[model samples]
Target: MSVTGPAKPNFAASGRRVFDIEIEALRAVVARIDGDFSRACTLLLATRGRVVCVGMGKSGHVARKIAATFASTGTPAFFVHPGEAAHGDLGMITDADTVLALSNSGETDELLMLLPVLARQGNVLVAMTGRPDSTLAREAAVHLDVSVPAEACPLDLAPTSSTTAALAMGDALAVALLEARGFTAEDFARSHPAGSLGRRLLLHIRDVMHGGDSVPTVPADATLGEALVEMSRKRLGMTAVVDGERHLLGLFTDGDLRRTLDDDGIDVRATPIATLMTKTPRTISEDALAIEAAQLMEAHKINALVVVDGKRRVVGALNIHDLLRARVV
Candidate 1:
């Protein structure tokens, strides 16, 4: 005999129904955000140590993500599984830490088992539970009601809407704390050093620019023909027009060559680069951020820039390719 279920359900309809239920569940959690939410923020802000997140089962998974978000957004935090806490991970929790516990029913056995220990350690326990009157809620220093109207699951047993509510509430807390602490993009980049955002925010123009002898430069009085040779040798497709002391005067590029070719009586070999180059060319400081260099390229509708020093002297040169190679683009 084979196990047969109800008529093949329409996945689309089922999914839509689930979305609708979860939306209402999310809406319900908003009204529950009262003075208790404010108190939880206060406790987290005042913590001398990390924010320790604890939960079991599905809530544990949510707890892990919450901890990660908090840590990355300027709040030092980590997750400790409730079951693991019973087996000695409880030592990780300190009296200076603030504990954020999650339990949809407010009666998870593993979490309840750790209540006395949490109290003994003097950890500020902020409970995110669906049942406000449950044991965990009653024991918590601050209770965030995560109750929902109903589960999106047809059997009302799977942790769907409740998990969504808890996750949203966690996000609310992280964002609130982030704003309170004035966390910035640079601060986040420090925490995510290996990510693309870190590359954009931390890497400076000098780090990737072609400097020293690699920078192609021709004296302002040098002929276009001489500039072309410098451009070819450097392979940057452009050459800076500078004074005898390397002070930036203008820029001549491969495109400038083409435009010069169209004009009458213009000899690439004889015409001074100063006469053909784009005067007052766009330039950036070598200490400027690579992303700033990228923005300059986009804003000016150009591909190359002369990297200058405090004295506006040409110290290096870079093109959009350098920005791309550095992954700033």
Candidate 2:
């Protein structure tokens, strides 16, 4: 008798099938948007207090993420677990707040338990669910139909397609409110002070560059040896060549020195920096963003930059390391 191995599972096909189901579910729900969506946006836009999101199980996870997105995008919001709300966490909700509830079946006991209290308090109740006729949906002031044709799971038992629709709908609400409130990138950065966008917009060259007495600068008539001393003392890997009135004349970097040495060029003690410096070196204003400085360095294929003032006077100097430390790199 010949032994045969069990047939292999088609993992890729399984994934493709799941994707197809979710895509179809999304398409079906896209056609369900009606006046309810507009009503939800109006309630969110008119909310003077924070948005209170509550749900149970997987819907609670989605609700938490939605709350975070709303908070970061200029709307004040927080998540409250419906199970905990049956205890003391319900104190977190008030009539001044708007309640956003999520439930795939629209009959999650823990979530529905709060409907009566919310109704009595006269708080706006917004529900995202698959069953429009369910208790939670019927009690909602604004019901968003996040119903899907079928769950991505073969058994139709998972929250896959339904959760995706809820997440997307939450994003739609956040963005609509964001645009209506005229939220700008700068304002967005304020909420994300520790993130890359915050660093890019809030940090100026002056904040990162070496300024005042620490600036690496050598007079145009200074010998190469003197420029080397300044570069070493300041440790910026380069020195600015400036004129008598403090105007930037040129810049000399380690790269320039190495190239000159490769060519068997001038004596370090005898040659004036004016003869060896790169005239009209790339410069940035102290007021310019550190991100802009990084862009300039990357575009020119150079590492260091001289920070200048209104009249092209050397105000400071910085290199790639400075940007790295500032997290602008």
Candidate 3:
């Protein structure tokens, strides 16, 4: 038997309809946020223990994401399935902990069953539900209304808009808490040490720049040919021209070499690098961020930079390729 679905639906139009419904739902939910939101934040902040998030089914998925957001944004939190909590996982909740429960209908049996236990244990309960009059909301120390205008699902039976509302509310709470705690980007990087953002913010020029004998250097008095040999030996596309004490006097690059070749009168073997090198080259401190080095290159339209200390002595060198290798570009 051939089963024919409804005449070919317009997929793009269907997607747009869903977006329209969800955006309206979010607006409705946003208008309802008032002092209750502030109260929820204050209660969570005052907790001496972790925030334990609990929910069932679709709400459970949202709860898990909410828990992750809270944990990553300076609040210690984790999700516990309401069903599993019945099988002894409830032990994870202590009197000092705050419980964040989610239920679209506020009548999920598993969550309702645990309310008595949570109450008797003296744990503060914060409930997120579509119905303010539901038992879960009634019993909660604070209730967050996440009701939506309707589901984005065509049948209006699936958990679409309601879940979106819950997730948005969860994000709002997490960010508000993040700001209240005075959390910094450095603190965020510490928690996300392996991510690209951490690499950009935590990595310094000294950590990525070529140092020691690997750096291409030539005395200011060295012949242009000698500087070219040093540039080739180090493969940095450029060489730092230094004085007797290794103080950076100038820089000579492939551009300078091309100009020297064009002049015909300048001899690579006879001309001192100091006369042909750039007298005022851009330099950066080794203590600067690798990202800052990238910006400096982009701003000045240069390829390489000499790393110097407070005394302007050459310590290291790095170029755009080095930033790319360090994944800072």
Candidate 4:
């Protein structure tokens, strides 16, 4: 006779248990932040050179992210694999730099082996570990205890909650330093020039607006048929109705054309474009940011806008498609 096997445990329930435990562990870690945390921040802030973050195993992943966070938030920092450092990657560190080393056990052999040389190089060493009294912590100038009650892993051997706590601490450090240095969103955007926020902040309307030959325009006295031809030829779905001096008088769009067609009393071919055009149409300045242009389009429920100069004369035109192509939408 075959024996019955034990029932399989609920995998979802196990996952929830792990998540709950890690959440509590993170809360405890945050509550433990005190004067040492402040001192650690002060040490990093006082340093003149880049922050060299080092770690091994899973902690290494957290170290790399932390270094990136610090770098993007106005702190000069980069990650150095401790194992690689022993074989000459240590050359990246300088006498003016500060080293942040991560080791859950606080006695990582590779990290401890390099502490002396790093210290001799005059680099300030900050150790983050679970054991405050470990040799690595004792050798460093500052010791940040990232000790957790226990690992979230049922086996209690994997680095789970501990790594999460370390990551959170690193984020806190970067944000605090960011605020301390008064690093604004513009500064952050400069570091990430290829990202959406960079485009939004750095790109001006004039940079993307259609000017000169591309701007669909017609004189105020132009007939509606002339305006429609200009709009269709330019393909911007709109035309600027300007005065003799090129000052903006109004705007004519496909929407207005549709409304005029619906009104049987109006004749698109005979009526003057200015009579049917929208007066006081939403507009933006050439100096405005592309993000502002996007906002204006969104607020007015229109797809296109006329761009004017400081003197309120039409200089350019743009549509929602322009913002999308420029990655500013």
Question: Against the true structure, whose lDDT is highest?
Answer: 3
Clashes of 4: 0
Q: How much does candidate 2 score in TM-score?
A: 0.93
For residues 1-329, what per-residue lDDT tens digits would candidate 1 score against the true structure? Answer: 99888898698999999999999999999987889899999899999999999888899999999999999998999999999899999989888899999999999999999999888888889999999999999999999999999999989999999999999999999999999999999999998877899998999998999999999998888998899899999999899988888998899988888888889888777888888888888899988999999998899888999999988899999999998888889
What local lDDT score does residue 73 receive in model 4, on the 0 to 100 scale?
Answer: 97
Q: lDDT of all predictions, in order shown?
A: 0.92, 0.92, 0.94, 0.92
lDDT of 4 by residue, 1-329 (tens): 99999999899999999899889988888886888889889999999999999999998999999999999999999999998999989999999899999999988988988988987899898888988999988988888888888899989988999999899989999999999999999999999999999999999999999999899999989999999999989999999999887899999998988888898887767899878989999899988999999998898799999998878799999999999999997
Stronger candidate by TM-score (1 vs 3):
1
Those runs of model 1 whose alpha carbons end farther than 4 Å from true positions after fitting are: 1-8
lDDT head-to-head 3 vs 4, winner: 3
The CA-based lDDT of model 2 is what? 0.92
Error of 2 at 156 (Å): 1.6
What would you estimate as the lDDT of candidate 3? 0.94
- Listed in order, each prediction's TM-score against the native is 0.94, 0.93, 0.93, 0.95
Stretches of model 3 off by over 4 angstroms after superposition:
1-6
Clashing pairs in 1: none
What's the distance in Å from true for residue 311, model 4?
Answer: 0.6
- For residue 111, give model 2's deviation from the true position in Å: 1.7
> TM-score of predicted model 4?
0.95
| Each prediction's number of clashing residue pairs | 0, 0, 0, 0
